[model samples]
Target: MARQCDLTGKARQANHKVSHANNKTRVFKQPNLKTKKVFDPESGQTIRLKLATSTIKTLDKLGLSKFLRKYYK
Candidate 1:
């Protein structure tokens, strides 16, 4: 499974690490993703999703159904 935020579409970002000598090394900045089980009150089902911490915070505020209704097409 990829490290991504399911709700926000956040993914890895590529960049270079620069050293004192100006040499660059390729690197990836991955989102803070965690596997969580979110329960949908309307459906009475628990969904497992990989989401960023920020998304989780938003979900905590708006709830699963409202968040899904607003975000999911």
Candidate 2:
């Protein structure tokens, strides 16, 4: 699977790393992702998902059903 959040589609970002001497290096900033088993109240089941930390936080707040309705639609 790709390195991405299944729900929010968050992925690595291209950036640069700078040094004190003004040197720069190409870098990829990866999202904070985790494999989680979230309970879906509507389905009465636990769904496994690869999600970003922010998405997980929002899931905790809005819940799976509401979150999917809000974002996944």
Candidate 3:
């Protein structure tokens, strides 16, 4: 699986590192992603997903269906 946040679709960002001598180096800024098993009380099922910490917090507050509806739609 790719390193990405499933809920928000956050992914690695491409950037350049500049040195004092004015040399540039390519780098990737990856999101902090974690695999989690989220339980849906309405569905009575647990779904595994990759999510960022922020998404996880929002999901915790809003629940699965509401979170998806609010963000995905």
Candidate 4:
């Protein structure tokens, strides 16, 4: 019997010495984030930003609106 990697759809037996050739730890980092807000270099106006880890579900709950963004300024 073997354990399959859910992400890459690969199969490997349990604790069978994962080699550098089959390294999976280099995939991603924990702090997968981006700038929640970007300030203008000149006028400092708030620009709506897209952070990869900040998905829609979290935004919907945060009520991240244009007006609400004023607080950051």
State every prediction's TM-score relative to the real structure: 0.84, 0.87, 0.87, 0.24
4: Cα error in model 3, Å: 1.1
Off by over 4 Å in 2: none
**Candidate 2 lDDT for residue 14:** 97
Backbone-clash count (model 2)? 0
Which residue runs of candidate 4 sit more than 4 Å off their true CA positions?
1-17, 20-46, 53-55, 65-73
lDDT of 1: 0.91
Best by lDDT: 2
Q: Write the per-residue lDDT of candidate 1 for residues 1-73, one digit (tens) a residue.
A: 7788887999999999999999999999999999999987778889999999999999999988788789886
Residues 16-49 of candidate 3 have per-residue lDDT tens digits of: 9999999999999999888999998888999899
Q: RMSD (Cα, Å) of candidate 1?
A: 1.5
Question: What is the Å distance of residue 35 in model 4 from its true position?
Answer: 9.9
Off by over 4 Å in 1: none
Per-model root-mean-square deviation over C-alphas: 1.5, 1.3, 1.2, 13.7
| Per-residue accuracy of model 2 over 29-64 as CA lDDT, tens digit each | 999999999998777899899999999999999988
Each model's backbone clash number:
0, 0, 0, 0
Candidate 3 global CA lDDT score = 0.91
